[model samples]
Target: MTRPKREPRRPKTVWLDDDQQRAWRQLLALVMELPAALESDLQRTTGLTTFEYLVLANLSEADDRTLRMSELAARANSSLSRLSHVVRRLSDNGLVIKSVCADDGRVSVVELTKAGMRRVATAAPLHVAKVRELVVEPLTKAELIGLGRAAEAITDRIADSG
Candidate 1:
């Protein structure tokens, strides 16, 4: 008689040690809380989510306030589907527009509208203030530099792995 197949055992979750746990929790809190705080400020002032702000910010810095959809998705660190949803919202809000790429008919390009520029300009100061209040104000100058370096290193590692 043929034997039935057995399922593979699940790997155990590795719980962090005390020191590691503390740092991990801190990082987790920062990742979750900071964005919520920033989003609150953005919503209160400009009626935009943090994601919307990122999209507008990316377009604002792009050549002629425009970028191909794929590039924008990479820069925003979001999936194409998520980017599409946000872009549709922004388009509906008159903050951005989408068009067929000139160089590649199959590709799409997203551009910031003048209204988006004005809105982002208005939101910039508020967003900066909130960031300063939550993250920067708590760190020393040296700590700030270290934090930036650490973030860059993490980003580089992710890019390398990708």
Candidate 2:
């Protein structure tokens, strides 16, 4: 028996209005520029890339200054493979130590060392100041709260889609 032919469905394309287009383009610009600016600031002040600083900072906040590699990857918004490479580099620099989890030999864990703690402590103030200068200082309290809510909503949508 022959099967009947079927029509392909096209996705709906809703074009943005002028105001929306302008707002969207501005958001895109901010996304691109903000990370670059923050990275530059971090690199200049601490000789660390933003990702490296994030890794260190996240670890510094954990209890006992330790986290499982997988957990760290999640917290850093990184893939396990990418986190492994960075953790290795950090281990070599004595900023952190990588070890087999004591409770689970099959699992890997990382601990921030005194050197890492010190580095993050030194970098935190500079990073915070740069963040305030670029992001917070220009916005009113209401605007900041609105921005936060908007971000959370977008993030929730992204999570749902993913």
Candidate 3:
């Protein structure tokens, strides 16, 4: 069938104003730079990548030092595949053990070994010190609280969008 050609509609685009632009750029820089800086310090001091540290740390904080694979992935903000790969590495190092859940054989669970607990314990202070130096010490308490609120709001927005 013959039809008239029509222009495709474009979505409306809203431009950021100056203050929003500046704030966004600053946020972008922080997002890119802060993690790298923290990872560098953690690697130098603890011989652990940030992801590894996070996995260990998260496990350390869980009930009985254990969590199901999916739950761990969520807590660490990682995909199940990536978490499984890292868990494999940790298992190889005897830092964590993975097994089928007793209650649900379909589910896998991870538990921190004594060695893993020790590793996280040792790494924690160094990590906290670095965090304090880079993030906390520079800000007043009120500003830090406000920052926390802002971060929570941003994370909520992201979670809602997804």
lDDT tens digits by residue: candidate 2, 98-154: 999999999999999999999999999999999999999999999999999999999
Instruction: Choose the strongest candidate by lDDT.
Output: 3
Model 3: CA > 4 A from native: none
- Please tell me which model should have the higher TM-score, number 1 or number 3: 3
Tens digits of lDDT, candidate 1, 1-162? 999999999999998899999997988898898888888888998788999999999999999999999999999999999999999999998999999998999999999999999999998898888889888999999999999998899889998999
RMSD of each: 2.6, 1.5, 1.2
Q: What TM-score, over all chains together, does every model reach?
A: 0.86, 0.95, 0.95
lDDT of 3 at 135: 99
TM-score of 2: 0.95
**Which of the predicted structures, 1 or 3, would earn the higher lDDT when compared with the native?**
3
The CA lDDT of each predicted structure is 0.93, 0.96, 0.98
Model 1: how far is 21 from its true place, Å? 2.0
Clashing pairs in 2: none
Model 1 off-target regions past 4 Å?
A: 1-15, 158-162
The residue pairs found clashing in candidate 1 are none
lDDT tens digits by residue: candidate 3, 34-145: 9999999999999999999999999999999999999999999999999999999999999999999999999999999999999999999999999999999999999999
What's the C-alpha lDDT at position 49 in model 3?
95
